[model samples]
Target: MLYSDSNSLVSFNPDTHTITVIRNNIRYDFEIDSTITQQELFLRGMYESRGYELSPIAKLDSILHINVIPFSSDTEFVSLKLDSLNNELDKFPKTHRKTTNMIPSKNYILGFVDGESLQVYYNFPLSIFMKKAWNNILTICIITLLFIFLMFCIVYLFKFMRNLSQYQEDTMNKIVHNWKTPLSSIKTMVELLQKKSISPTDEKGIEKTKFILEEVAHIQTGSQQIMRALIDAIHIQIDRNEFDLKKELITLIKEEKTAHSNQTISLDLQYLLPTTTIYASQFHLICAIRNLIDNAIKYGKDAPQITIICYQDKNNLMIEVKDDGPGIPKEKQKLIFNKYYQVVDKNSGQTRKGFGLGLNYVYNVIKLHNGRITINSTPGNGCTFTIKLKKWRTK
Candidate 1:
């Protein structure tokens, strides 16, 4: 942190194998640099000059609390450690210009010389980066769990379908067999991750790793809640009650609009539907509707527009959700409502990631209310999902 004569602030302790740097009149200790080679420094200089991505390893030395790492050789330099990182600073100037532009401008390089007179380049925030990594890992874990569950469902459905016909039995068995490899691979990968123990080399690493794992546990609880909802749908256990359909939808749309401020969402829309009361589980219906809206958001293009339509069609109350998103294929439409089925990315031939239960839960939840849901879509046009429920019920 010494703005003037910062070079004089650095010193080395051979006996302790550490480096000491005085910043803002406070003493900071870092381990002595021993591992980096000249070739790696050369590569580092080239990589930072052309690439925008920040380095994974955080540099230890800093001026005025801004981090800077060695981009030049150790032939002539000062060793520094402020917050436990042992790093070297090159006495040369060219490396500073190459590395500073790669990160956000919170860093300024004044005089050059391996981040010397001009200092601080790509000050990577390890904790923030670590959090992003943990979230991605957690998402992958939840998806793997869903894939496993769906695979089992396919096997179970195959068994049930076997009783229907011999042709279906063979076809279903082939599907189950075709699906096994990827499922096994995912399962094996997750198992390996679960069994392997991670050991952090320093106190900072240990703290960050512990924080990420703890966060993973918190998010896993949320995933479990979603799975619980899917399981409840499978069991067909929902409390039925009479609620004003139009009012419910108006509220739903209002909520959705708030949740997706960037996207356009509307209800009844151009014209409001007349008041219609229907006997059904409001909780289940709301969940189902939300699922459809979520699907629309994910599959929709940037700033996608969604509209909820409600009206009376004879004795049935009809509700429709329309999205200005990529339309579903005709062949994939039927499979969409099947348990554990997700639309494949036509371009990549990869199954799209989705909520754990997906449309299958919505389909079943609607069916439980003696209602039906249908999709009307054409590729490149957009998608519309309509739900029809009896206006009145006898319980």
Candidate 2:
């Protein structure tokens, strides 16, 4: 005897070459042959197994017009009158290729009739058995890997396009700077020459010459900035530059302190840095320092106090410029370093006008050196700009 959770008992009858089932107080019997192929036996076993697990069992007896059961609920078992009786029900059934499916259908019909209460007795359809789960899991894994590959490709393409866009912007900026410088210089020189030809005793002529010299100096400063930007953009684009981390950031700190002797700020530079030299462009480093200094001078608040310090931290250089300024709002700190961004003095309420390019130049220079610069500021508190440059050595 074999029992399954589908509420059936199975037994074998060797004399009759049959399989028998007892389910819900009803008996079902199947007459199969010893001559049946092993494949057909296996298929029959599978259907019988499903019936025991999922539903009640029934034996199809084609010879009788009525379905046979031991006991069925009065609410469930009902007889449907046949409009025409076919003596065909008495014949032993013919087996077709599709007859394999009918075994489970026969079992389900028995289960439905035992449980359902209806006037009409309808045929029940068999459920399609789902294969094992591993195959489905494998298919899902394959599809997921394909989707990940596609996403990676899209990210790579976007990165490439962004780099291309940056290159074009750098080129345009350089060209515009170049064109503006020469014309500006020529205009200053022309103005100076004209001043010299004016009345000899006119003191205004001398002042005009001095003014022309200052104009030339300003243009020189601007030219240097543009050149630095162009070089940094090119080297960084090619990945040829790295941070030239210094162990003694204090060296520059002391020099800057001496340069701005009147400021009330104090210096504190302490973060461990490697003594090892980094491979970087010298021009870019100097420009980075210059931009920071320029920023400190322009924006330092009470008594224009600023402190410059540096030190080594692991494999990088940490240089900091802190100032007691009418601190930048938290929201504005990020925007301030962007190109063409400037914060006006709160007292003045007017947009402080310069090239609005200083901090932008600083950020680009630091980045080209494969470094990062960040701002720390709070309202009513001071601001500190920190530059971190990585350490690298040439093989």
Candidate 3:
């Protein structure tokens, strides 16, 4: 029995002519000739011990390229063959034998001695290093892409929220402006009544009272219109009634002319049919017409000439509102009916007043009646908005 390091133990069995080695908790057995000399046995044990120490180096050689050479004093004794698994070894120049004191140029060398001197050389090629780093490179690329996508989503969400906020603020300002005129009128009437200098029976007093009542009615109508719009936005059903289409247009034109009497805008109505009845929501239809007239008056150059032609063709009632205002650009005609999209004046490069919701509302109202609207315009040639509705049939 022979004990070497704390982890290695060797035992020889004379009867069975076998040697057993226990190293690092692993056991190896080798059969021997029954007449083998003690010196040969010792040499065999030394070889096995040295080979066990080189096992880790062999594993590294399988992953990299390593050269092993044995020397005796200053003379070359033996050189180990390249590992069969190292396919890249043949691509590089062969390693030359060197003296013990000479420094290696490329390979890393490790030297040790048993009974003879041995040196191990290891070389790390670029391809092998890149192969080991491939997983990290892929992980970095995926993380960078995910970060970019996240930033894009965040920026898009912020812009959408900003646009929504601006739209809401503009709508509120328009609502206040709309209500202010009637409210001011009501306030003036009450202040006049507070002055006790006039009798109730006086004609002027009665006229003042009537004007106050008219202002209140106007406020009520405005409130009702706002509520109707809100209901429509929520997709609620609207009430429909049958009415004379020609008469409705004539009445609406008169009302608009009276409302804008202070402005010099001209309103012309041409009726191709004396009487045409249509089943529709009268309030929404009137609102749609009013929006177009108001837009003409607001955006017109000087005395805007608006000509509205109402006629019947086949089974459809066609109404065309033509205005001789600064015409809309060809590019913007398609987007004008979209909510919150406003037309910009090409010459001045300034946006027109209003919330940009009027045309969109008109579009929605017309669609609710199973109608379609189309626009035709050229730069500086004025604009025409044409609406077609299915004629109501009485069964």
- For each candidate in the order shown, give its overall lDDT on alpha carbons: 0.57, 0.55, 0.64
Off by over 4 Å in 1: 1-221, 228-234, 262-272, 348-351, 391-395
Please list the Cα RMSD from the true structure of every candidate, rounded to 1 decimal place. Answer: 32.6, 17.0, 19.1
Give every collision pair in model 1: 92-113, 92-114, 93-113, 110-118, 111-117, 111-118
| Candidate 2 or 1, higher TM-score | 1
* Cα-based RMSD of candidate 2: 17.0
Candidate 3 whole-model C-alpha lDDT, 0 to 1: 0.64
Model 2 lDDT tens row, 1-395 = 32233555656666777877666667778889978753444345435744533211122221111222122111122122111231122111223123222322121222332343212232232221122355787899999999999999999977886576467555644543454445454654555476567666878876777677677657656765665466445433323344444433454455455434435545545544444355655434644665676566656654666666667677566778887766788778879877667787567675664666767767876876678999998966778888887844464
Which is superior by lDDT, 1 or 3? 3
Model 1 per-residue lDDT tens digits across residues 1-395: 11123323544455665555664576666664456443333333323332344232222222222212232111122222122122333322323444433443333333333443323334455554555588898999999999999999999977665444344323323432333223334444443444464344456655655565566445544554545453544344455678876676666666555445435544335324555666877666876887788788777877777888777788777878898887989999988888767776769564655544668878987887778999999988889999998844543
Residue 287 alpha-carbon offset, candidate 3, angstroms: 0.9
Per-model TM-score, in order, reads: 0.41, 0.39, 0.44
